[model samples]
Target: MSTVAPRFRSHAEDILDALRENPDREALVHGHRRVTAGEFHDLVHRTAWAMQGQGIERGQTVTLLSGNLPEAIAVRYAAHLIGAQVNHLYTGLSADVQAAIVHDVETRALVVDPRLADRAAAIVEAVPVKSVLALGPSATADDLLALAATRTTDPFPGQAGPDDICAIRHTGGTTGHPKGICTTYRQVREQRKAGRAGAIETDAARQLVATTIAHAAGMLADGVLESGGTVVMLDDFDPADVLTTVERERITHLWLLPPLLYQLLDHPAMGHTDTSTLRQVLYGGCQSSPARIADAVRRLGPVLVQGYGQNEGGLISVLTPADHDPDDPERLRTAGRILDGVEVEIRDEDGSALPDGEHGEICVRSAMVMQGYWKQPELTASVLRNGWLRTGDIGFRDAEGYLTVVDRLKDMIVVVGGHVYTTELEDLLNSHPDVRQCAVFGVRDEDGMERVHAAVLLAPGATTDSDELRALVRAERGAMYVPARITFPDELPLTDVGKPDKKELRRRATTPTT
Candidate 1:
């Protein structure tokens, strides 16, 4: 009788194949230890077997809360192998928010590191979590090995289809609490394809993940695994650790947000690190200032790529390496053209198509777009029309078919006679010599009209007066873009995912104006 191999139905299978093909190759580098592909696959299968031995059924949702440890990635894959939906939360989430997501997703099994076991217990109290498998300091290497010994090395029964839900990610909300954006196995698979469409795929490139692996970037890390690449993981951002890892691993591919890239370039040893192996650098959390991009290009060559998308919409547009020319006629203004399998449209209030160079809301439709909000049908209906997902961002498209994101629709500050985009003003301000980062908010002035209020954080040991900064912005943007009042701070608030907490900034801006 011919025994048919189990279908490669899950992403775990993809990892397993890669492991089997290169058992001796280093798959993950964390801390002082590195695990080969064969050894890693053994751990994954054994973990899946152990979970099955514990009566954890397939299709059950499991909440994962841990730092960017190699085991955390393994547990996620083990869940995938057993056909469980992995609910990943940011490790820095508050207890209340954690409980909310646990309850919202109905996650029964909790796989968390011992460092966060207390938080896991808090969540268990709020929701009836069936089982808790702890890893790290509280548990020993022997404990994990013992669990693997108890379960057979053979794979557990698989029970997932490509159409089944694979991952549940909670989107940061503006109104109340965050809502889960459930992604199907199909959607996640397509999003991975969209994220790596034009990029050269090579197993020789060592991927170093410096950002928190909780958001879309986390999924990108998993995509690296799917592509048969080695990953260097980090629990937190430390410039020295990043530089050391890059040099040690001869890292060839790096993906970072603009802020993190800025920190990396400013690191004391940045100039000394051997970065010749870096073949590609991708950044796309938000729009980066032109000056910052130029700095990165100068330091890391012209390999910088920018991708624009959100939790609701997956990869939408990409600024390829070819578009990194700082001296181009457009001068690094556009966000490059839309990627393959993406359709972008600029629509007016009535859903009518806007003319080129005229700003409007951006709407996108593709396989990469998310399914919908997990439970909020009303909200889902509002944002997703037919098959298109409406991104509440305002921007115009140039005649050459490049998209330029201006600002969020709700964040547009309407002044006395015209509308001003906070992001545009912030970008212009960030390009100034002394301004490291800035945010603009709408505050009421005389006559109850909304006026633009600016808050700035300066670079270390940098100095510039408000008058000079104002004059710089006025000269670059115009009088309308100048803030009515400007304030300086040592730093700005950041979200768990490391994006600027603009909501908090607006709250602070609305504070009595004292």
Candidate 2:
């Protein structure tokens, strides 16, 4: 960890100091407007004071529903200053799912972006939240900006301890209902410190944040601001907008999931845009196609950096820009070496450690790991055993210490005869030139036997026979690995966090057609 002076009380303090240091520097940019560091700090202070006035106390939860707006960042820092646990609702989730998370966290106050006021109102009705603050005009909630204007722009008197719960980030809910991961101020600080030591550039990083600030993009934005960098926020992701923003802002750092990266590559504007200023293009959240990643490196230069992490384990590993080499294709398959000061071990079902080259659960022990799941001791204990977070991902370490994630344990196809990993089949399907994207899973047949099934999205104006695709899989991995059914869908459903919605896919695959 980077040595910190005693004056820095918490992560919020560090940011406040950074903001003060560069008062005139651009802290956040959204559409046509930009907020300077000084202005942003004052906004955060007022927001914190307003929340305190609304009966929000330390340890209480403040749930926010917004995109990557300037107000969202302010509210997050405001919650941090007042020592309240902030829960960011995944905007893509259904109202019911978002309501469940609010109730699960026992949110004392709810904040909404004007665009999502209806969704927030639904959650407010479902949960017993005491207060509702909206970023803009709203019929059902108090206006946060209006309230901030009335409040003094002085720092909140209350300060959070290092061990205080800073944020309650929910899981992506790829498998089932999402669970809140308890993250502390100290954990976040340590992760930032470690990130700065490696991937985080020392020079001012002009970062383009096109994804939801509720997830990894938010974390990166925080780091950039703390290091005296600029955060360029986007309300929603558009391929053309991303390319244009990178060029317009001379964006040095950006983060995207593999799927979004593919879209940018396919977009006509991608080749025409000037992306020379981009120093790093961080990607994660799901497994990526090696062929697509290599293609990106060729087109966009060697700016691709793959980050492998979860809500529980902050950042386990990162495939650095130096590692993205066309000649060394095998390294691209790995999730990169274990992060500094993080211990990653592959363990069997019995909780015994497995040797290198053996596929098993990836367990992590690090300062960045979340404290535990919120208010779910049993569920927390199931994964957090002996201070090691048992990441449900099935992966193995190579002889060179690189981690290669095979598939999610629950998503593994279990046939009557043997098991089939979805990733293996997905990789094969993705290799086809005509295939834009694909998802593979196990579905029950008429005889109640689990069978391999696949849903694919073809490239624009491209066509391929399902039988030929199935035959390709059969020839590569034998009959057992071949999908029993292959359907060409316009597009596969995606989870709120942008991962392939395998749970939804299984439901669709098993549903009887008329």
Top-lDDT structure, candidate number: 2
TM-score of each: 0.92, 0.95
The 0-to-1 C-alpha lDDT of every candidate, in the order given, reads 0.78, 0.86
Residue runs of model 2 more than 4 Å from their true location after superposition: 1-8, 200-202
lDDT per residue for candidate 1 within 389-455, as digits (tens), equals 9999898888877888888887899887799998788778878877777778887765789888888
Off by over 4 Å in 1: 1-8, 136-146, 173-175, 200-202, 329-331, 443-449, 510-514
102-219: candidate 2 lDDT, tens digit per residue: 9999889889899887787787788778898899888888998898889998677657878889999987776678888999988988878767655755358999988889988888
Error in Å for residue 458 of model 1: 2.4
Question: Distance (Å) between predicted and true CA of 288, model 1?
Answer: 0.9
For each of the candidates, the C-alpha root-mean-square deviation to the true structure, in angstroms, is 3.1, 2.5
- The true-versus-predicted C-alpha distance at residue 310 of model 1, in Å, is 2.0
